[model samples]
Target chain A: MLIQRLAIIGVGLIGGSLARALKRANAVGEVIGCGRNINNLQQAVELGVIDRYDTNPAQAVTEADMIVVAVPLGTIASVFAAIRDNLSAQAIITDVGSAKATVVADARQHLGNYLPRFVPGHPIAGTEKSGVAASFAELFEQHRVILTPLQETDPQAVATVSTMWTQTGAEVIEMSVTHHDEVLAATSHLPHILAYSLVDTLAKMAERTEIFRFAAGGFRDFTRIASSDPQMWHDICLANQQAILQILDSFKTDLTQLITAIQQNDSQYIATVFSRAKSARDKFCG
Target chain B: MLIQRLAIIGVGLIGGSLARALKRANAVGEVIGCGRNINNLQQAVELGVIDRYDTNPAQAVTEADMIVVAVPLGTIASVFAAIRDNLSAQAIITDVGSAKATVVADARQHLGNYLPRFVPGHPIAGTEKSGVAASFAELFEQHRVILTPLQETDPQAVATVSTMWTQTGAEVIEMSVTHHDEVLAATSHLPHILAYSLVDTLAKMAERTEIFRFAAGGFRDFTRIASSDPQMWHDICLANQQAILQILDSFKTDLTQLITAIQQNDSQYIATVFSRAKSARDKFCG
Candidate 1:
């Protein structure tokens, strides 16, 4: 087995799905789930997503050969602190937080001597749904998992975590923690913020009901991400503040240019921007 | 039959789909397709989307009891001018433009006495795909069709046009020209512009290919409208400038507030906005 005992803190969609996938591949001997919500942890255990469940992170990771911190960004530091004292020296630590730089920083702050075993990671996979019941073994298949290992991280720890993700049918790639933050800020976080802002703006309009009633498939698709988890996104925005703000500024500048083009009746300018975006999207998304 | 001979100018997705739907419902005796693109009109004829094809709008609308102008917003006036002299006194004219106020203004400028017969409309239905070949009979199924009839417009013309859309399985609703423009500006035009702007901004990033590669399902859904027709969107942005600008300002304000909340580490504020948006979207979109 890849791991003698695998402990996952926060047993939600990401943690539960990883446990299930590892169990399915027989990559881990025993899976233990740790979370604040007893109901969720209980459900994970009852659903066979975890071999056992515990509320105390320190106790859960005491004998674990691997520990995965799969919690919200705001709770990362506390989770790291809770598991630090009991973590095995040989245990490889990783996480599935959306923002890697902050997670790495939180690990450095709380993990102390165990920092070398901590490999920051983010698996670029999930649905809008949450909780253990919504997770499955195939959740990570054909998906990309980015590992942003810190300077003090052990190479073997990174490799072990990478191999575990690979066993789940994920393509694992490594990058700097800062680079991961910047890339995700532009690709994921900014889009979610825009979706929420747009939906909120429209929902406040006087003719909101009719506006929504007549919204076509395009509008539905464009705002689908607005339906995502609020607290999770709230933590993400705070954790990756600088990178997200920079990207948001860039987007605002671009939007202002479009607004000016429309105001000036510059059809050519509008068409150029739209065509360029379409070509790029077609090339990449196709 | 609802009409003896119906002429459809600019027989692309909207026009061709309407023809097909009307034909399927046996609501029109004959359909004549008119457009600048000879290839698309010929294809529409071959596909039996229209009974006949003509390049000249004037010739196409001769003796036609109904004329549906479905060209790009920028070309609406010219199309109306082309068909005005040939239109029978008893014929009713309508358009499927995205912006209603501008369409109404254009009809007034070009249609002369026929302005009373012109009913401005926007059928909130379309795929990213365009042209006659992309048209389908069920494109308007369960879709909303907004008609913004002019004050001088005949009630009989409005009723007839509304009935025709209803026959094609669309729910017909009427609003004033300005109200339609404002609602559409908030719901449709603004979302499209945002999608195009976001896609354009990200495509110009240095790590663009990698960014697109890691973009999750949420990003794909949020930018799906960015793949829409460039020319069509350009015209829409121009035609609906005032209303769009108003809504854009509101969205910018909300976005600024969100950015401030994030920059200030106001997690509660961010969560409130996101939760509100999620609740609104789920209630409306579900």
Candidate 2:
């Protein structure tokens, strides 16, 4: 009921799931799926994620009133460039990239006149899986959708994008692109980096075989994100390099201090760190 | 059927759960729960985890055919020193400590001749919650139980401990105490350390109030172990300091390399790391 013509570029998990959710909610008129993979487009159509499919990003944009680019962070610039001229004069464009600063900057660079309607957005929801087959309408339900709009971005476009996400059951919040990058670096980017690093270190150890077998539930749960799309995480780390590095430095400083306390048998210091961490986890995580 | 006159020290989660499992399997004739906490002992008896209770560790060990020391790792030495003269001459002693080498060495220092029967064992299963109230009979069902016996450990005593654990539906395996520490440094200790560190960092951030509200499923799953018993993790980190530090150093090196790859825009290196980690996770964790 809210959107008339909706085009989803790179119809993978996020795009396909959004398409399905729009159909389920009856929030959009016509849904179009666009991607480089012809098979994925056909599969999306067969799966009814979209009413139709198109391999041409520009052609797909021309037939839509709104476009949602759901691709890896590194590819957002190219996708925007490809469809910038084709998007309807009044069409609102958004993205589901993990990093917003780089993507916003890329949109500004690629689409000069269209910058006001390029409402950069990120849905804080994902699984350790990818592709159209992994999508579901409820994927965005109860999730956070952060919109990072430049000062030049039109308020009207931002409201439309925010309302669209709200229709899909997401809570929308506005944030500066830089702050979004830093906040997510601590909350999301750093955790994935640690998971991949730990797994890589364990693999290099001589006890890798037995270590893997005995990993059990805790290790499995802790490292679950390491199984995510490698290309996607790689793009995220690169796009948000400075912020992720800052967080990693902070993490190392804290870890080293805790290690030193243990080495010196500083039970009081250890207890304080442990107690504070426990209280925070209980309060925030619960 | 596999044990007799079993004495369980500490009468908390692991201890109470073991007693409950033994009773359910009818593997022991008389089960005794010992702890400084009088209420915990009464509660354990009320919950049918123990046939009887003892406030004094020595009195609890006097008639036991086997003794299972399930106190915190930091208290293992003092517990052994207190019960050294009370343990039955033919009794086989084992512990359910996370760190094996330190506990085994402490037992050796205090129990001397009885050290050969003091086989160190670790049940690789636990919940984030603690205490007698959170325990259950099937806590160790189909779980891995690793026995780290010293070179001078009695083969017969090792067999007895293995049989007891097997009766509780745990698959018992043998490993060197040093190897056990190193492997667990990666599998359990490091994961916990990272979780605690991440939670602490996020809770102290400027946007914590807002971020905590929007923390979706991924953040919740990643930090689930951060809610574990802080005292328990503190003991584990301190007891396994050397191995844990080594693993932390290894993880830091791997993370530094990843950071460098991201900074330099080395997509190939980043992609390779991700692919290898993804494959390793799929093969080992899935």
Give chain B TM-scores in order.
Answer: 0.98, 0.97
Per-candidate TM vs. native? 0.97, 0.97
Residue runs of model 1 more than 4 Å from their true location after superposition: none
Extract clashing residue pairs from model 2: A1-A27, B1-B27
Evaluated on CA atoms against the true complex, candidate 1 attains a DockQ of: 0.80
Per-residue lDDT value at B42 in model 2: 90
lDDT by residue (tens digit), candidate 1, A140-177: 99999999887788999999999999999999999988
**Candidate 1: clashing pairs of residues:** none
Stretches off by above 4 angstroms in model 2 are none
- State the weakest 10-residue window (summed lDDT) of model 1 chain B: B216-225
Candidate 2: tens digits of C-alpha lDDT, residues B1-286: 5777999998888998898888888899999889998988898888888889888899999879899999999899999999999888899999999998889779879997898888899999998888889889999998999999888999999999999998889999999999999989989999998888888877777778876776667777778888888888889988999999888888878877887888788999989888888889999987
Model 1, B22-68: lDDT tens digits are: 99999999999999888888789899999888899999999999999
Provide backbone clash counts, one per model. 0, 2
Instruction: Kindly report the docking quality category of candidate 1.
Output: high
